[model samples]
Target chain A: MRFTSESSADGIVTRDFTLDGIPGVLWSPAAGPSRAPLVLMGHGGGNHKHSPAMSGRAALLVRGGGFHVAVIDAPGHGDRPRTAHDEQEIAALYAARAAGRPEGPIVVRYNAHLAEQAVPEHRAVLDALQRLPEIGADGPVGYFGLNMGTAIGVPLVAADPRFTAAVFGLHWPDALAGHARRITVPVQFAMQWDDEHIPREAALALFDAFASKDKTLHANAGRHKELPRFEANDAVPFFVRHLGSAIPGASPALT
Target chain B: MRFTSESSADGIVTRDFTLDGIPGVLWSPAAGPSRAPLVLMGHGGGNHKHSPAMSGRAALLVRGGGFHVAVIDAPGHGDRPRTAHDEQEIAALYAARAAGRPEGPIVVRYNAHLAEQAVPEHRAVLDALQRLPEIGADGPVGYFGLNMGTAIGVPLVAADPRFTAAVFGLHWPDALAGHARRITVPVQFAMQWDDEHIPREAALALFDAFASKDKTLHANAGRHKELPRFEANDAVPFFVRHLGSAIPGASPALT
Candidate 1:
């Protein structure tokens, strides 16, 4: 992992880095200890690693909670070049939608494989993140990802035992169900009641499958894309309670 | 599952059905025994359960090989209604391609979730197919799903032990790798050398991941969409040899 650029603003130090060709960003609180706890944020599908939703949550952790935050684009997403299949599929999906037709098997087939690859890729990123001295090698860690991130994070948290706390949002059940059984970390899962994408029953099924001793389901009234703002409110506190109390919520005095 | 429409042509009985809400089709050779071998043919992404490619294979097995064939649409596809999210994402993907910009994160996130869901959807269709008397409860079974179908087929074949043989085409590595390990059945995997979609290395990785003792890799020269014509020529014989001897390639005598 190589740190390519670093800058500081308003007590937050942000740096962009590359790990084995995967580009990502890290945000740290300036006055925090060199060994502060860290959190990994994941963006939703069709969005980059530092999508506004992901970046906003990272900002909350850095400014409100004095923790280090990290995020990376899943393969063929964000700064990475998408594949020809991907390009064609997306175009077709759009055409179908524009023509008021269903995308059919295209979206599911396209997403499932990427989700499968993203989980291991997230672990690879975690392997590299542990080497950063600013975040401390042995500090407790947390994860927060939704939709595509949830698909990626669920398998990742299940496979890796390092995450002490996690927030999985906007995801539904399938192959990820069995993996949920292996996760023992404290978890906060978010869902939208009127989610245009995910089925309500599937979301409930996924939440029920988590083997975590302590897990909370945060259900809000909105669509899938409208979830991030509502998420940051609960997510900050969820991470603070499990990882540490160093971080504030939106309020500075909360910490 | 409700069999909505049943039709007979050229001594082949083709039935259209909807399992719960998922639309599907079953092709059965009229003269075969009640428990003749059953093979499921899956369609590619952006195509319905009975796309010309899928239907042609079904017709071959039923007429040329004297077997039963089944297929279904992936969620948000086929007769199913596409979601607002699916349309928006596809449109965005197309715009990116049209502008010569990479699709990046959009494709990965969109596909990861869909791929995860499609496998089970395929399984559900399989479950429905088994209940039909035309195929019977305990007949030999094989699978053939390429591209999007391959994505769904890999996981379905891994989870279900009922399959004795399979033909996976137009696929690549990642999620399918681990799933491939559980498949100990006789398998035939196909690819294209100059394919416009899947990466050659990724396809090789998927082929290598299979734990099957008998597996053959067929690499031809063509684009992604042109695979069905080449595949039908070989896959028909493969299923016949492994599952049972009933299919004769494109012979008027058999039909």
Candidate 2:
């Protein structure tokens, strides 16, 4: 693991790093306990590691729950180079969307392919991240992702025992439900009740597949892209509840 | 409205009152603005206005959101006298429970019948409560109820325009779907994914029937009676978001 750059603003310190050539970013409180729990976030399919969604949620986790948050670019996302296969899949996805056809089949197929490579890369990143002096190996870790993020997260959390909690949503069950069944950690899943792309039944099925005894499904009334922003705020407490806040008295007032 | 008893404890003032022979209780912040928003709550079947769920949630609204909370006993509940009809329905419900039959049908039929009477009573109480100097008629009001409360709240909120937001769940939609369609206020609904009494499809159907442009469903992994306690805490922010807190900067940190 090698850090390329660092910056600080608004009580949060941001560090950019690369491990095995995979670009990643870590966000932490500028001033707090030296060792805090870490939350690994996976960005959406077309988005990079530091997309607004990732940074926004990272801010919430860091400021609200006083936790460290990190995100890494997927194989063909962010600053990474894409293979011919990745190019073909992206073209197919765009073609489906442009033709007003179902995007689920193409997205499911493409994301599953990416997950095959991304999961092992994520484990390696975790191994490297845990070695940092500020983030010891034994601290609780959580996963937060939605849409394509959920697509990759199900299999990752299922295979990785170090993850203690997860927040996932907005994806179909086609390629993920089987892995979801293997996940036993507490989960907070979000979905669009009237999502145009994913059928409501499919979303429910994925939530139903989680083996966790302490799982909560948050279904908001909206189209696929119209997921209410408050869901992001809601996830902070879920992590606080399951992972336990490392910063003393840092429990947030949900806005 | 007439107050029969009053007590102050734990930063909340509790007042027992009656309007035209109906018994009810009101909870409010001991110190804050002279006037605050109000939330009307409904208790479950076989439960009274002062059940633990009622007082517990009242504490949340009063201390967390700085709102006044009120709940009145449905006809044949709490301090009220039961009619022969109420007695018969209670007996039938008990028999079904003892026989290990599904309780949905009995609970639905009985609660719907009770709601017919309770709706008008709730309106009258709201009118009298608003007449108080502290809770003017113009202040925003919200409704919070589950189980039989949802049964009563769906119609009550549908019929009353004064209510700006509501939290409802845990009832079959057989008798309430039509009313739910009429409610356009923002809503936060809760249900058990594995509820023994209500089918999963039934719960989803009720949530789908809501016409609110902004609504959310929180489905936890548990049976009918095992709803996590944090949901009550979650409702405070929902009310605060919609009604606008009156207690200047008194946002309670979520535990």
Estimate, for each residue in B1-255, the C-alpha lDDT of model 1 and write its tens digit: 898999998888888998778888888887756567789877766788777777777877776467888888876778988889879877987897788775434544555557687777777777777787766767789999877677778878888888989988676666578889888897778776455556766765787678876565654444555553534755665676677755434322111
Backbone clashes in model 2, listed as residue pairs: none
| Cα lDDT of model 2 by residue, B1-255, tens digit | 899999999899999999999999999999999999999999988899999999989987887788999999988899999999999999999999999998889889999999999999999999999999889999999999999999999999999999999999999999999999999999999999999999999999999999999999999999999999889978988898899886776533322
User: How far off is residue B18 in model 1, in Å?
Assistant: 67
TM-score top scorer? 2
| Cα lDDT computed for each candidate against the true fold | 0.73, 0.92
Q: After superposition, how far is residue B15 of candidate 1 from its true place, in Å?
A: 77
DockQ, all models: 0.01, 0.56
| DockQ-derived CAPRI band for the predicted complex in model 2 | medium
- Candidate 2: Cα lDDT at A40: 96
Q: What are the chain A TM-scores of the candidates, in order?
A: 0.90, 0.97
